[model samples]
Target: MKPFDFVQPTTTDAALAALAEHSPNVRILCGGTDYVVELKHGEQSPGVVVDISRLEDLKSIELTDAGLRIGAGVTHTEIMAHPLIAEHAPAMIEAAHTVGAVQTRNLGTLGGNLVTCVPSMDSGPVLLALDAQVTILGPKGSRQMDLSEFFVGVRKTALEPDELLLDVIIPTENLGKPAGFIKFGLRKGQALALVNAASAFRVEDGKFKDVRIALGAVAPVVMRASKAEAVLEGQAVSQDLIDEAAKIAVGEAKPIDDFRASKEYRNSLIEVGTRRTLQAALEAANG
Candidate 1:
């Protein structure tokens, strides 16, 4: 790791001031899961490293009038073990389990993962399917946007150099919304997802309602497969309808031929993933 000045700010205002002072030379340190690896690889060497990991206000998981407020500094381990999350949105816990091994999960933050904006991030698909929003803090105060808009591209985000991700919020209406997340990696642990997908919907009068299908790794960003969602919306539940919807999902992703998997293989996985998540979510809703 390159030598750098370190600052541990106790308040958001202090962190903002430090960021403004350092401006482009500052890197906000959250969980150090991705950043530490980057530091060792010489990917970044900021002049000032602002450690926001100690910010108590940013390390929480609770319910608010708005919905579930998951602080940016909350670790994956916390998410996995939170009883409120298990009762209200277990799909999040399911996704968190696929993030990494026990060690990484202990140190990684959900906001940090989303802020990194990697295409294959395990935390994204389920959140996207659930219509999650992200809040960013900077010198100007706070700005909130859809998680999709927050992602710019590979390893890039809409955040400016002086900005910090605050948290991810799943709207109250979506609480207990039947959602499912699926990830296909080379191995069970410490493997990057070849193709990951999530689905959420309601079964109203035995028909699908407000269906959402999100996919990752196969696209530049975690993307909603609207075409597939359209196929299921208002449609009666059936294996045939789900199979058809899954087939449409394959057309929405832009998978590439790489060493991890071929384009054809990814397409097959996308179909299977879409179907399985939808079925799982439907079961959750029924229960």
Candidate 2:
């Protein structure tokens, strides 16, 4: 790894000032799951590494009147094990399990994963399905944005060079919203997703309400299959409707041909994925 100056700031104000001082030379260090690998490969040799990993202010998972508040630094392991998450937002736990192995899970932060903005990122689909939001801190103070807007492109985000992500929030209305996430990868463990999908909705009086379906690794970013969701909203709940919704979802994605999987195969996965998650989410709603 290339040598770099390291700074560990304990407060957000200090961190912001340090970032301004270091400017383009500074890079924030969270869980280090991706950044460390980049350093070892000589891909990024930043002049300064600000270890925000030690910022205790960023480590929390709580519930508020607005919804479930997850500190950006919360680890995947924590998300999988937290009682509040398991009971109120279990789809999130399902997504967390599909990330890297135990060692990486213990060290990787949700903020880091979202900030990386990889197309197949496991933490994305479920949140997108739930219409999550994010909080960011900067010299201008703080601002909140939808998770969709926070992601700009592959391995990129809407955060400015001097901004730091603070937390992720699932809106109060969506808490415990029935949702499901699935991924089709080369293997059960340590494999990047070839295609992944999630669906969320409520079953009210045998009809679908607020239906949402999201797909990953098939577009520039994790995106909602709005065309498919539109087909299901207000529709009578049934297996046949789900199947049709799945077909529509496949039409919404633009999967690519890659060594991991063919575009045709990914399209197939998108259909099956959409159908299965919808089924699972409906079951959750019924319970």
Candidate 3:
């Protein structure tokens, strides 16, 4: 790993200041699950590394007026254990459990997963399905954007070089929303997803409401299967409709041919994953 100046900041303000001082040369470190590997591999060579692990403000999981607010530094293990997350967004717990292993879960932050912006990240699908938003802190102060807008491309995000992601919020309306997540990988554990999917909706008068279906690993970024969702939205719930929507979802994605799986195989996974997740969400809505 290349040598770099390290600054451990105890407060969010201090961390932002450090980032501002170092500007484009600075890199923020939270859980270090992803960035550390990059550093060791010589993919990143920042002049300064600001460690925000000690920043208390970025380690909370609370029910704010806006929604369920999860600090950027909260680890995957924390998400798996937190009562608020379990109550408001149980599907997130399942998603968190699929991340790496026990040690990686203990050290991997949700923010880190999102910030890395990998297409197959376990956290992306559910967050997108739940309509989560991200808060960012920078020299000009704070700004917020939809989680969908936060991701730019492969290994890239909208976060400015001198900005730090603060927290992610699942809107109050989405809290307790019925949702389901699925990750199809080469192995049962510690495997990258070939296709991961999440689906969320509410059943009202036997019709689907606010339908959302998100898919990862089949595109440049995790993306909502809007056309598939449109197929189910306001429609009477039926197994046939779900199967059709799942097929529509496959058409919406642009999966590439890769070593882990072929494009055709991923397309099959996308269809099955979408169907299963949607079925799971339907079951949740029913209960």
Instruction: Evaluate model 3: give its TM-score.
Output: 0.99
Candidate 2 achieves a global lDDT of: 0.92
Cα lDDT, all candidates: 0.92, 0.92, 0.96
Residue 128, model 3, lDDT: 98
Mark the regions of model 3 whose C-alpha exceeds 4 Å error after superposition: none
Model 1: number of backbone collisions: 0
Q: State residue 237's C-alpha deviation in candidate 3, in Å.
A: 0.5
lDDT of 2 by residue, 45-110 (tens): 688888898887689999988799999999999999999999889999989999989999999999
**Residue 223 C-alpha lDDT in model 3:** 99
Which candidate number maximizes TM-score?
3
Instruction: At residue 180, give the lDDT of candidate 3.
Output: 97
Model number with the top lDDT: 3
- Model 1 over residues 86-175: C-alpha lDDT tens digits? 978899998999988999999999988998888899999999998999999999999999998998899889999999998889999999
- Candidate 3 on 1-287: residue-level lDDT in tens? 98899999898889999999998998988889998988899855799999999989889999999999999999999999999999999999999999999999999999999999999999999999999999998989899999999999999999999899999999999999999999999999999999999999999999999999999999999999999999999999999999999999999999989789999999999999999999999999988
TM-score for each of the candidates: 0.98, 0.98, 0.99
Candidate 2 residues lying further than 4 Å off, grouped into runs, are none
- Which residue pairs clash in candidate 2? none
